[model samples]
Target: MTQLSLHSPVGELTISEEDGVIVSVDWGWSPFQEENELLLRAKKMLDDYFDGEEVEFDLPLKPHGTEFQKNVWKIMSEIPYGQILTYGEISDRLNSHARAVGLACGANPIPIIIPCHRVMGKNGKLTGFSGGEGISTKRYLLELEDTFNNLDDNLSLPF
Candidate 1:
């Protein structure tokens, strides 16, 4: 596996890759010391994302989790870069329940790639983020994507 470290507003990120596919993107409690071709690409991609120059990611991903978790992650990836969803909405999509979706979000191994931050509570409130970073980080990311701007002004119940 190859690893690369980069900086973000939340913290330093360490992106791990295996077999040429990204396996994880983790927040580092300490600075990571490694670099490689895959890491470079990951850095560039993340930079572009933070810079608002990219939306959907095109890098190889190798998430390791249960089938349900993978499904949740897949749905999360489908969320537009600037859009957000509620746990209940994801459960409806999966024919499951909000608790189940929340569990899946908590178990998300790939954060930014899978886009767990894009998930919010009903009423467009920033909710749980299991990345150990906090919902504020999630909000920051969402705001970066312009998903939160004017959200307060357009407060209409979706369901």
Candidate 2:
């Protein structure tokens, strides 16, 4: 595995790639000195995203997880760039309970790329985020998107 760490608006991010596909994005620095086309592309896409540019990552992803976790992550990838979804909503779509969906989300290997931060609790309440600064990072991401329904009401933004 080749790991490259880059700084982002939230914090330092370490992206790991193996066999030409991105494997995971951890929330810290890793000292593996290697870079490839795929890692470079992922870094560029993440940079564009943090710059408030709407970006759809067009790279290969190879997250390791169970079938159910993979299914949940796949559904998460379909979430719009600046849109938010609730665990209950995902559960309904997958015919599973909210807690189960939340578990899968928590187990996500790639956070921002897979967009587990877009998932919220009922009433758009903030939930757990297994990333840098936890829920704060999640809120920062949502705020950065600046897609809140009512811009006038700062608190109206979905978390």
Candidate 3:
């Protein structure tokens, strides 16, 4: 896998690619770095996104996962920027369960580009995030995009 690191508001992020397709976007920096046209473009899009530029990523994403997880990721990818979706909504769309959908969201390899942070818990509750500073990272992304429709700033999560 080829990895490239970029600095964002949340912290350092490392984007991984394989076979010319983006496979993951992870927190922190990678020990190794390789520059390429694809990785460079992915970095640029992420920069725009963090800068609140409403960038629609045109890069090819191939997050490594199972069929169900892939389906979940696909649904998440379609969620427009500055929009939110609940686990229940995704479960209903997939004919699955909310817990399952949440699990898939947690397992998402690519975070921002796939928009997993846009997903909320029951009644727009903030939940666990696997990247950066957990729910805080999710909150920052949501706040950055101004997509907190049902979420309030007065949760116990300490913003």
Candidate 4:
């Protein structure tokens, strides 16, 4: 596994990949050490994204998963930057049920790059995020994308 650390608005992220495919992306260090090349490039794109200078990622990413999961990730990859999509919409597109779509979303191997955080429940409700950052972190990501326009005043950010 190859690893690289990236700084973001929420926190520092460590992204890992193996055989040119993303293996893991977590909030902190992992015990395993591996060489990193494209990992560094991913960090750079993430930086540009958080800085609001870049909307889309241009990187070779292969998220390993089952065929169903891969299909879910493909639809997720189409979610334009700074935009949000309901889980139901994804289900409709994939001709699957909403619950199944949610399951695939929770199993997303890559978060920011795959843009899994852009998926939400019906009516803009925050849903599950498998990166283990919790709902607050998920909300922060949505806010960064300018998709959470109805957050409470206290939760509103200056930027």
lDDT of each: 0.80, 0.86, 0.89, 0.77
Number of the top lDDT candidate? 3
TM-score: model 1 vs. ground truth: 0.87
Tens digit of per-residue lDDT, candidate 3, span 1-113: 89999999999999999999999998888999999999999999999888888889888999889999999999999998887888999999999999999999999999999
Taking all chains together, each candidate's TM-score versus the true structure is 0.87, 0.92, 0.92, 0.83
What residue runs in model 3 are displaced by over 4 Å at the alpha carbon? 149-159
Separately for all candidates shown, the number of backbone clashes (residues 3 or more apart, or on different chains) is 0, 0, 0, 0
C-alpha positional error of residue 7 in candidate 4 after TM-score superposition, expressed in Å = 3.4
After the best TM-score superposition of candidate 4, give how far the Cα of residue 109 lies from its true spot, in angstroms: 0.9
Find the 10 residues in a row with the least total lDDT in model 1: 150-159
Residue pairs clashing, model 1: none
TM-score, structure 4 vs. true: 0.83
On lDDT, the stronger of 2 and 3 is 3
lDDT of 4 by residue, 35-128 (tens): 5668777777788878876467767778778898899999898988777778899999888999998988888877888888988887667777
| Candidate 3 worst ten-residue window by lDDT | 150-159
